[model samples]
Target: MSTDTDTPGGDADTAARSLAHWSEAGRAEMEAFYALATEDYRQLALAADWPTVLRAVTHDGWRVLDVACGSGKFPTALDRYTDLSALPEASYDLLDPSTFSIAEARAQLRPPFSAAREFAVTLQELPADAGPYDVVWATHALYALPPAELAQGAEQFVRALRPGGLGFVAQATAQSHYLAFYDAFRAGVRDRTPYTSAEQVADALRAAGGDVRTQTVEYTSGTADRAVAEGFLQRCAFDDAVSLDQMEAAPVLGDYLAGCRDASGAYTFQHEVMLIWL
Candidate 1:
């Protein structure tokens, strides 16, 4: 899960530093990240018939807002998995704190996902008149949102949707590899709070008066290539400074990685993601 939003809390400065670091990450670092992380979007696409789902809310001159749209992987996955030609054209606005990410995402858009507006701001800072969009989504995004700002972010998410409009968020649960591994990373390396979980997202949305429904999708992503696994894990933690050798030797994180490794030395990352509908 990639994050493009800022956090608000006692750790806000630390969070901002992390976001800034990610924004300035080199091209090679970003490419390495997506090498394994692209599966995140692929899995979400396989979870549903996206075209039919989007078509349900499609109307004349309809539009969608993609919150924290990092590299537009969700739309890319949708284009790959569905018949985009069958869906009517719709404007897709992107919102994110990183201009680099917004630009990368914008370049990936195609018909039915015509790139329209770009908002270089955090989700909480979305314009008051932003939208009553036909569809709003944050796929594999929002993990960096701190607990203190979740309520406000959730409210903004719900507020952006038109009545009967679709809202979707795909995130890993507390039990999933993403969340569990991050907790270990904090204990062993960073000493920061864990990334936000799907459970928390659902709770925040419900608390914000959203009618939320959830479904679970389980899978594993593995690699026999140590370099690939290393890149993936580093990106997952958003700290490339910590190498694979370091992670494998770390205390809590080392133990966690051992559990994910096979006798053949392959790494299999288990994922139990929650598909949330609002």
Candidate 2:
């Protein structure tokens, strides 16, 4: 087995450049937005079925793979819930293409946790040595991948998992309330990637030879402050084709933000989570 990194798309430079401007300042801005957004990271963590999945793997030590594991948050959270001392010995592989994210994960990780490994490679080019993990996790990552690429990644995920092993693939559904907001916000923006619906994702998994189950997790923001709304808008306005000025100028942006802030002044968003087994 070899663990060579490959970027099948050959677009690492483009991706790195596009993400380079998102420095610590940008992260602070995004964190502020996350704090204000109707659906906070805490809610996403709780609603993501992490606890359930961990329970499933707690009995025997399981080699886990977290694809696009941002800031190592999910794995860290899993450690907290599973109680590292009581669980069987386990190794975690954190894979992502962002150097900044990998750095953050390394700094945040506690002892006994697996060392963070950086990969500027895409899912299609996952390292060959990652084979046959007991659990494969791709939470909130697949939605960012192109549909075709997502399918390819899913195939890789299944191949990497042992037979009867579990895989969790969470994606944003077309029916999500935030779809309208995202669509209007990215209107006319070139190189913008749209989210794939849950149905499309489940079908792709089935084609990849897995039995899949799905759930809808809904969350609402309880605050309607304009600063929060603007922050949310700014965090999402990172595509090369879309400028922050254009986003601010869009009439639809203001209207949609207002609509999201209900009588209580909170913005709410929804997402779909898919669970599969190979």
Candidate 3:
């Protein structure tokens, strides 16, 4: 695996600082991400939850680790699927870099719905007691990080897992349909990084000394109308670049939005979710 010294938005310090601060712009971006994502993503993500992955693992007490456990959605979903049997009284550590996301996860988790015991911490600094986890899960989080950080994060996951324990890292592939909007939005404005393919991710994990296997899961969503498109756009439009001022000035933005509003008045999207295991 080769490392790119020229970071995505320039220097490492700048990128780190930008990520660390969780500025209003960053929050806006997340909001946009959620908005544009929720409609299509919720179903796709849930569908990716194949029970065979969990059923194959046999551990004494299922201690789980959810890396980049944004809003605790996947963990919560897992709890619902496993129920009182097979996955009773499981422990979960939700690791993420954004305090905003952590806070959201905390707020979202409550009541009988909250079956798995949970905790939240940043990726670089996980709690000392978090480990020896039986099952490690990382879904859609690796795409945000650069190669070096991703490698380091993988090491952390390995360290947290017990011998013979299972670790699954789900990465979005380059062929995902959202790349259309993302690429067009970044064209001529800034250099936006694309997702690493499953093959590349499998190679990287193997190079990093993890026994790995890969699978590609394709998902397609039903067409969404103009209202849905607007909602999606609003949900994912964050930062000054996607702000009202920028949107007003960029003719392409209008064109893109119009294009999203198809002749049938419904927008369609497709995605490839890659599952890697160790």
- After superposition, the stretches of candidate 3 with alpha carbons farther than 4 Å from their true spots are 1-8, 11-36, 39-52, 55-60, 79-85, 107-130, 193-199, 222-240, 243-261
What is the C-alpha local distance difference test score of each model?
A: 0.85, 0.57, 0.55
* lDDT for model 3: 0.55
lDDT of 2 by residue, 83-182 (tens): 4454555566667666676676666665345563456556678888766777777765554555557678768877878776777775556655445555
User: Which one wins on lDDT?
Assistant: 1
Report the candidate with higher lDDT, 1 versus 3: 1
TM-score of 2: 0.75
lDDT of 1 at 155: 95
* TM, every model: 0.94, 0.75, 0.71
- Candidate 2 residue 220 C-alpha distance from true site, Å: 1.2
- In Å, residue 62's CA in model 2 sits off its true spot by 2.7
lDDT score for residue 216 of model 1: 97
lDDT-sorted candidate list, best first: 1, 2, 3
How many angstroms is residue 52 displaced in model 2 relative to the true structure, after the best TM-score fit? 6.1
Residue pairs with backbone atoms closer than 3 Å in model 1 (clashes): none
Clashing pairs in 2: 38-221, 223-265, 223-266, 224-265
